[model samples]
Target chain A: MNITVLLKQVPDTTAKITISGGKVDENSVSKWSMSPYDEYALESGLQLKEKTGGNLVAITCGPERTKKMLTDAAAVGADTLVHISNDGVTDSTHVQKLLAAAVRRFDSQIVLCGKQAADTNSGSTGPGVAELIDAACVTLVTEVNYSEGKFSTIRPSNSGTEKVAVDGLSVFAFDKGTHELRRPNVRGIMMAKKKQVESITSGDLGVVLDSSNVTLNSQNPPPEKPAGQKFEGAEHVNEVVSKLRNEANVI
Target chain B: MAYEALDFYDVDSLLTEEERMVRDMVRDWVDEEVIPNIEIACREGVFPDEWRVALGEMGVLGAPLKGYDCPGLSYTAYGVICRELERGDSGLRSFASVQGSLAMYPIWDFGSEEQKNHYLPKMASGEWIGCFGLTEPDYGSNPGDMITKAEDMGDHYLLNGAKMWITNGSIAELAVVWAKLDGVIRGFIVEKNDPGFSAPEMKGKHSLKASVTSELVFQDCKIPKDRMLPGVKGLRGPFSCLNNARYGISWGALGSAQACFDSAKDYAMSRIQFDHPIASYQLVQNKLSWMLREITKGQLLAYHLGQKKDSGDWIPEHISLAKMNNVDIALEIARVARDIHGANGILDEYPIMRHMANLESVKTYEGTHDIHNLIIGRHITGIQAFTREA
Candidate 1:
């Protein structure tokens, strides 16, 4: 079996951000690490490759700096890397179409990606890509087992929980708890510097889409939540309740 | 006794595979060479001189300095080596510390190009022993009060001073001595064969017994003017050396505490108390848990500080905090570990007593607990609390 894990390079969540003149201050934003959920996906891919004796390919779509993320994944035992370079991936549909077209280029058996990126929290891209490719899609899978050309996955559902078993050539949106991410040792990191990374431009795919419709509408800072309101003591509890009931009219 | 999982704590995470390999190499060396003979060496109150050449052969001397056949390793790697070395005995680590951090670092950092080319490679190969002379009889904590004077001669400098509590002083071929010249502190590379230079071994030290500690005396010792370190002036040179040594101590103390914790934990699990293993008791579990927590915290602190040092942005106050926090916790862990061993704790056959005694020196040397607290105080309050007037 051949496994391909899709990784994305998002700004580290711990990074402090500043917005001035409707643009992110790049100078203030320091790049320190990969996304945590994507690390889990990479770990799952490596484990699957280890278990099934298959080739693991890590794919990413971003600017040039995304190559570092791909290289990091390769250091953790990914066999190959496929980088799809473009700057206009804002919506799920556009990213899905782009990844689907790239996936068709490789004869991969199973595809995997994180349940959601910490940056956008859209949680749509993996399912969208599976839909576009017309393959069996499972999301929020916390555990995975593959044997005899069949894949079994478990995920939480609104009612309780659900289990799905799909045949070969499926896509999975893995949760963070799926597996422990292996830290690349010094030797592995050094070896990663020598691995081959193939970069493909969207133009090379021979498919043209209307990118103007996918253009980002000015990025803005997230709105700050309101500060907590403090009540003095038990004596103020009734007063706060009355205010909520009468003035706020919630009761 | 076998090592417990908790004894490793955050140690493994902080090391790169290369650094871990270096650590494992040193660990294997200590287990094979030092641990078996440590008690005998301590009883004799002398470090085996043969191990000096052996450690030199193992590339443990002057590891972090770049160029000149030194290991040229990352600062964190040096810290890991120190930690592992000190785990066997502080005496062994002290020998390495004097050669590496105190002696070689000053030369690498402040010496002239000529000085580095001549001394670093020889020292790296362990063909020579080196020691630092900074602490004076009158000035224990207050180095600025040093009255050691260096007068200018036509072709050589006439030096007059006495440095106490110098490590490896008796056997050192090269010495970096700090003295006041025209009311300015300056560093000079003094050779042992100089006409007026003498090093006498200090006697009757209960702690760091297996290590050599001595006093250096210079009376009209004529040193060539070229030997003066031109790059550094005043107390900065020696203080910087202390900062480097203190960073290693922060990690090394953890090694000692870990050994004690492992020994105690194993004893608790195996040694029967009232027909059951003491480890089954809640009190023993509490002691074990606390040791683990403190060791883990110290490990994380040292690892982060090592990263900062590697990045070339470490400050003295950061090192002070790590040293202060780690040594304090290590001492506590040693005490609790001793208690967990009960009667066996006081025996020299066990490591708990030796670790407890050595931690006393670790807490005092480099910087005392109160001194480090003042350092942190100055960093936090923007005030110099160490000075009486300030």
Candidate 2:
């Protein structure tokens, strides 16, 4: 059973968001790091690989800058690295197709990815890839147990948690798990420096490139909240009540 | 949130990705592990014993040494580790420096094959802690004139010496004791439990309080003849080890300065005065700008020196210059930071005072700032100043 983990390199969460020429200026980012949720996914994939004995392949679809993320994944004990070059594609659906192709190319029995990427919080990639590859998909998965060719997944549901046992191929989009990602020690980093990342164009995956249907007119920063008005003394209580009932419309 | 190292001049661009990764990993560990416990440990004046194994598992112990289960990292990476560790606290950085450069380095450079094979792996794994014994009670800067001696018996060597201000001495499993053998300095490995050997922990240290400072005492200690480091003799062996440590201190001081800078900058921005944050004041900006400028210069010095060390182009004078300048600047930055925090800086809640106090020791140790100046002065003028007649 080979496992594939989807990795995304996002700007540091603390980076100040700045818009330039109707798009988010990536150059403004002070650092590039792995998406937070994807860390959980990678941890889950690593655990699964350790238990079931399989090739752990970390796959990412991005431009050259994302190679650092793959190197990082390798440093944390990922056996193989795959980079799908989709430099121009920004569509969630198109990126999912490329990721699915790489997963299939690796002959993966299990696939794992973040519930959503930090840059684009559209929780669609895992399910979209699952649909494309015809594998059972479980979103918001926290843990997965594998035993004797069967896989059982635990995930949060509306009322309680659900433990779904699925046979054959499956995709687990991970939320926060019991285990966080492990830091790569010095020896691991030194060893990871030698691991080569297999870079492939969409052409190699036999996936034709197409323009994204979604067009960004402009990017804008979130509006700052107004300062809170404080009411003092017993005399202003009525005024505060009236404002809450009528002007604020909370009542 | 991800750690943003103070790279005002885009220094990260100059570093390799691996170096940056190493810095981030160590920085993260420090933030998670060391930062939380440092204040309490400093207050208690006790070095945390648990960190040895954790640091070993992280491969930070003897990180630059090759093989023997060591990480064999680049000098730049080793410098990065020191920088990050010192950013948490100077004590942590001192522990690593003494372990890697002072203790393990001498063994790797001068020890016999058997000694290397026996000690390096154990030290690398943190299974056995090691300390360097060179600085004597009477001989601070002048180690070559030390009275400590090791006598050669037919079957074993009799060692008698007392080493002062030894880091990791009390808990170390082995001490790399440098003593005069027939008026020539040689390295010998003294086991902690050896007869007539005892390491007594020195108490009442205000500086480097989070580190274990002890005295290594040897009273006619018996050592196996094979325990001696066979490859090297004379003052050159110890000087080489000092150079390695001095190089690391050059980088480690930058970390202490950076932590103070960060704390001061944040505190200044949030601390309100006269209906505005004190950071809006010109005086505050002046201090902040000065600190940033010095720290940036220190970073460049350490970075270039790390490159030179990696390429085998660096000389002892280069190490002295960096060690002297960086520690001096870091001490200055800590003072400025202490002022920026007003009265709050003195409290343990803020790291400014702690760093300020720690930098004092840093400035004094690894060849005091004045000693480094003399070393560099000799390099430039081709004249020895220490022994010159007034």
Candidate 3:
């Protein structure tokens, strides 16, 4: 059994982002952390490896600075790591192409990626890779069990989640609805000092950048919104529920 | 800015990867499990004993020791754990440090193999609670003049002593008691079940209210002949344990100071006065900047000392120096932080007053602030101050 997980280092969602020359000014970003949804993807990959008895490989696409996420992945039990160093990658389709080429090199039987990279919020990579590679794709998956060339998955549906079983090659992009993110313990961190993250260039992975696929769009900060309604006490429970059900359409 | 709002020096970069991992695990656990419920415990004057087993499961009790089922984290990691635990509440850190450095360190350092086999594993697991009884009712700054005595009998020693200001005293099942035997001081393992041993809770302490304070009483207490620690003699045995506990206090006090400074920074930034935020005032900036500067220095001191401990060349005076300087500075920071919070600080809704109160006890215990000064004072001068008196 083989599992390949995709992770991205993004500016924290709460970081104050600023734009210069139509691109994000890195100075305003307070810190870079692993995309929250990617943690779930890595956790699922680790759990699947635990159950099925195989190796786990974490792969990421970014500059040399992103190597910390690779080492951190190794600290949390990734058997090996691949860093696709390419600073010019921003297109979701290009990410899919580069990832598909790397996944082919590993002959990865199952692929796991975050549903979307938080920085861009363009959630096309997982399905994009599945489309380019011609494999079964499962989106917004929360739980997975793999054995004997098959996968049992749980993903959110209309009203609730549904369990779906599938066989053969597949891709699963995750949400944090289930599976608590496991922090790397001290022993694992000590072990990571001996493990190394292998580097592979995007060019070596046979990623041909199609210039036609690249497009520059307008970039602006999200608009400010009105304050939310606050309801307190047991007496307002019905009113709160009514607002949620009718006004906000949450319930 | 980096989670705690006081680490302007990026102290986390100085820690090893394992140390940082241990710190984050304990810090997150404290934020989620300890902080929300601690104010209630402090206001009601009760120790949150419920977390003891959870702490054991987290592998923190006796975590730095090499064996006896201990976790064996590096000394720096242990210090980070103390820092995070005390950031929640000092009482919790007191319980853990007493269990690890004070109670368990001695048995591992001096006890017989039989004694270690009997108690170390259970104590490490929090299956059994233990307390140290070095600070007696009559001896606070001068433990050498302790009147507690253990007279030798053919079968056992009859012990008579009273240990005050003992943490975890009333609740503990065992105690490592320091008493005189054959006109020389020795360490004895006294079980609470011993016929003449009793521990009663000391009451009405305005400071350290969230921790268990008690008086350890021994009236003709009988112990088996083999229960005495066999590895070392005299004050050397207990003094080593005190050094370890004091090292932890140097780091733990910084946590309290950091928590207070964090609250003060947040309060100053938000509280409106004189038609603008109070943070815009130069005086408020002066206090906040000083606190940040002092907290950074204290953290660096502890980090380097922790490294020295790891390399096994740590001078004993450095422990006293750190305990003296860090606690003194921390108490000052806590006071200023309370003033920054103003009326809101005196209430339990904020931790400034609680930490302010706990630090008062921290300063006096594990060797008082002045006692540490004299310890350092003697180290440089080759003179003993307390012994030369009278």
Best lDDT among the predictions, by candidate number:
2
- What is the alpha-carbon lDDT for the whole of candidate 2? 0.90
lDDT digits (tens) for residues B43-159 of candidate 2: 898889888878888888887789878888889888989999999899999999999999999999999888999999989988889999999999999999998899999899999
lDDT per residue for candidate 3 within A137-246, as digits (tens), equals 99999988886668989998999989988788899998884887776654566666678878887778877767545676768777889788777789998888898899
Kindly report which residue pairs in candidate 3 clash with one another: B1-B5
Give me the runs in candidate 1 sitting further than 4 Å from their true place: A1-251, B1-11
What is the DockQ score of candidate 2, to 2 decimals?
Answer: 0.56
> Per-residue lDDT of A89-150 in model 1, one digit per residue for the tens?
55666667778877777778788888888776778878987887788898888777887889
- Name the candidate, 2 or 3, with the larger TM-score value: 2
Clashing pairs in 1: none
Query: Candidates 1 and 2: which is better by lDDT?
Result: 2
Local accuracy of candidate 1 as per-residue lDDT tens digits, B255-370: 89888988998899999979999999999999999898889999889999999999988789999999999989988999999999999899888888888898898898888889
The reply for model 2, stretches above 4 Å from the true place, is A19-23, A157-160, A209-251, B388-390
Q: How accurate is candidate 3 locally (lDDT)?
A: 0.86
Give fnat (model 2).
0.72
RMSD of each: 18.2, 3.0, 4.1
List the candidate 3 regions with Cα displacement exceeding 4 Å.
A13-23, A147-149, A210-220, A224-251, B1-4, B44-54, B57-63, B67-69, B113-129, B151-158, B170-173, B191-198, B219-226, B387-390
lDDT of 3 by residue, B311-389 (tens): 9988889999988888888899989988988899798888899898899999999999999988898899988887756
The most accurate candidate by TM-score is 2
